[model samples]
Target: MIKLRPQPLRGRPTVSVVVPCYNYGRFLPDCVSGVLGQEEVEVDVVIVDDASPDGSSVVARRLAAADQRVRLIAHETNRGHIATYNEGLAVAEGEFVVLLSADDLLSPGSLARSVALLQAHPEVGMVYGFSPTFADRPPTPRTTARSWSIWPGLEWIEQMCRRMSNPVSTPEVVMRGSLMREFVGYDKRLPHAADLLLWLRAATRGPIGRINGADQAFYRKHGANMHVEMFAGVYTDIAERRRTFDILFDEDSACFPDGHQLREVALRSLAREALVTMCQAEKLGQVGDEPHDKLVALAAEMCPPERDPRLWRAYERTQTRSRSGRGPVVPRTVGRAMADLGGRIRWRRWRRTGLMSAVGSL
Candidate 1:
């Protein structure tokens, strides 16, 4: 167990915003400025250049020279993102820490808002705000009813498990430095979903807080995004999710004593994702057979034996639509008919089981 750092005395606590850059030299200044521009807060900015060929080190050094609070750590050799994060954490000295990517920008007052929430609620380990994902153009501002909301740790974890998707973007997140120090930096074995895992881990420790508007952060959707690579079949999202579940189970067995429920939730989530991916593939008719086969195989492994028939039926319908060039879109009447058919099938299944498995088997 790692020792927890003492909380700072009453006043504005320092925030260490670490910007890890690989080949994002052009966006480094914008990212650094976003951190420095935070309203009413003391921020220590650490810009880590991971031996980028694009002279990111030069930009980092310039930023450091311009501000006393800003510092640069340029790697002689290119270390992976995980290594750079750990290096930054090792050097960071702040009550709250944020690992902002060099390519992303934090919205105005984001740091102050996040810090205020953490200060108000000492029980929360991590706080994140809404981030609008955009490509090429900047996102327009949006309003919200409340500035922020608080969620109990376990409640937040349950919500994440149910959604099976990461709603918290990296730039919008602020973590308690002490809690972050408890664990080693991002897991190398699960690079694709390391941030998700970290958020879940933090949630296990305490409650989570969220600033409730898209104006908190701006997530740039470009070709270089790690998630885009994962979606393009460069890395296995399914396997990464599975590994994440296993890690969480091992770390917090007390929270999930059986592991059966968690496995089911994960499988169901994967099945849902697979269906969406299949729909996209069918609509485009461009995905290769190998990738599609892998998706099917993985889904089949997780799907319950009794629900296999339903899975096959859905697959056949999607394939038929794809080949017929009817596309993935369904007419209103056809959609209503399909929904009625599904209801009847679900009813029959429930009658046979003598219990309502509304949450159908994956």
Candidate 2:
């Protein structure tokens, strides 16, 4: 469907939130209510039911009926999440767009806070904030956004490449409608890391904004979450993230001059990740399930021997044996200590900022 952008509202900005559901009927009410109850924004929710087996369509229809701000688009056949996302985004007529998963939720003032940043900084095309993850019930957010952080598009891309991770989760992102529509949709190829790639693409258009000192959304953690289901193991996650970068470089390398160097940075980061995972597996004697040899090979392939000798030597030491040729008992101790230090650093970062510095096998 061709979207006709609606005229700007008189006072509040109109935000079109696309809540995509697939067998998450139980969580639909909470998800949609959060979008509708957002303060200081005229919010319209487009609930796209992707032909779920659970009675999600019924719930969506009921939501649409209950409020004029809510609309339902039920697919007869399961076209998958990528298609569903594009279909819903294609119909967004509001000033801003949010692709919120049905299982997640927005914090009380998330949309309004994001809108404020976007409205103030015309250079920023995308705005995201901290999202705290929860299991059963979400914790109430106490603070409001105290300040905003804005980064140039290229700088943001560089940061992403250096870290080789996604900072913004799905629900935490609020995209400028025009910039969001610049891309066709979430790439069908990247079922695991489409959101990461999409955010990078958005950053190419303009600067990125972040809301600080407060939470933006609630990221629900469960058995059936997409990341948990798709990336069940370490190897799968590392490979998919590598694929995401490949597509990113292929599509938007021209946008940034240092794209080649950034690609190498991302590759090395991922390679180091594999090596780290290999060490952890060995120390825990979990090598059987984790595939130590494959991890070593992946690390070698990504970083290469000449790229970084220290990292390569770490990999080699993990494979070395004692004088009796038994196992890497001595090296395992060192690896375990290194792993513990890395975990502590990551924990500190996560505690300081609600965002995870690294995600999915990192």
Candidate 3:
């Protein structure tokens, strides 16, 4: 049981969940249900509808009426998701906070597990666990947490810098309310990767925790998903990621002695990603001359020809193959085979641990 802090209205820790809705009225009920159904935690649901044209306000209002724990914030004008998220966060009055999308679902007992970690370890600012994605229906999630992994905040941030990707899928994250309030709101400058930035900022404040061998949330994948609609290509995604790293280091360089080195690490990783994408595009014949040119430009801009001669040479080889109009074929080089194996290993680790394991091992 979560030892209720200070104000224990019902002798339980209250978890305030913020659900942002936009044209997802059809999914609002299921999402709210998952949060309200979490065991052993008192939940307060705040639904912020961003002037969704799909009758989302009506759904939200109905939900609020049906359950006293649910509150509806209907925007008359269409504020973007960032503004909506901030407005909800500002009013959270609970021991813990969660920002869940209207299209996602929280796994059973997830809040309890998260609360337990926060109560036991006052130093852990945030905890997250596996969040599997589904299309039509949510899969049955793991209800029991078999183990926990905790990392020093700085170490986790460095691991994130090396990966150059967002590990936490929004709904799976549970943050201490006091720590979350200190940060205020998500950065408007990073609309595509605000969540990634938020996680990094949280790590700066205290230790990070991860629950293993269990699911924490379910992400719904569909045509209207923001990530799919906004980030249509690998190039845009990589650009935004690089921008995220730049902002992180620019703002908090004082916190890290190796900030410059970590930035370089991130840039090199991004460069390799761009080059790999170029190779994949050449093999599949999916990229046009213009897109291929953009990928090469990104690789050069990130890693430069002089900094990573091997990556540039590989880029040149890929360009030659693209010019020759080759179809998809098996990767023949040992380097390519090793890269594929490493990617698979990382994916499996993420599936089990909700994070990349063995930081600095690569």
Model 2 stretches with alpha carbons more than 4 Å out: 1-10, 224-232, 321-348, 351-362
Deviation in Å, model 3, residue 89 alpha carbon? 0.6
Give per-residue CA lDDT, model 1, range 263-342, as digits (tens): 57766666656655655444434355437777776777767436656666766777786679776676645644654565
Cα distance off (Å), candidate 2, residue 138:
0.3
Better of 1 and 2 by lDDT: 2
Task: Pick out the ten consecutive residues of candidate 2 with the lowest summed lDDT.
Answer: 1-10
TM-score versus the correct structure, for each prediction: 0.81, 0.87, 0.88
**How high is the lDDT of residue 306 in model 2?**
96
Candidate 1 wrongly placed segments (more than 4 Å): 1-10, 140-145, 223-231, 284-290, 307-313, 316-362
Clashes of 3: 0
Q: Which candidate tops lDDT?
A: 3
lDDT of 2 by residue, 33-67 (tens): 98899988999999999999999999999989999
Ranking by lDDT: 3, 2, 1
The lDDT values for all models are 0.72, 0.79, 0.81
Q: Residues 153-173, candidate 3, lDDT per residue (tens digit)? A: 998888887766578888889
Candidate number achieving the greatest TM-score relative to the actual structure: 3
* CA RMSD (A), model 2: 5.7
What are the C-alpha RMSDs, in order, of all predicted structures? 8.4, 5.7, 5.0
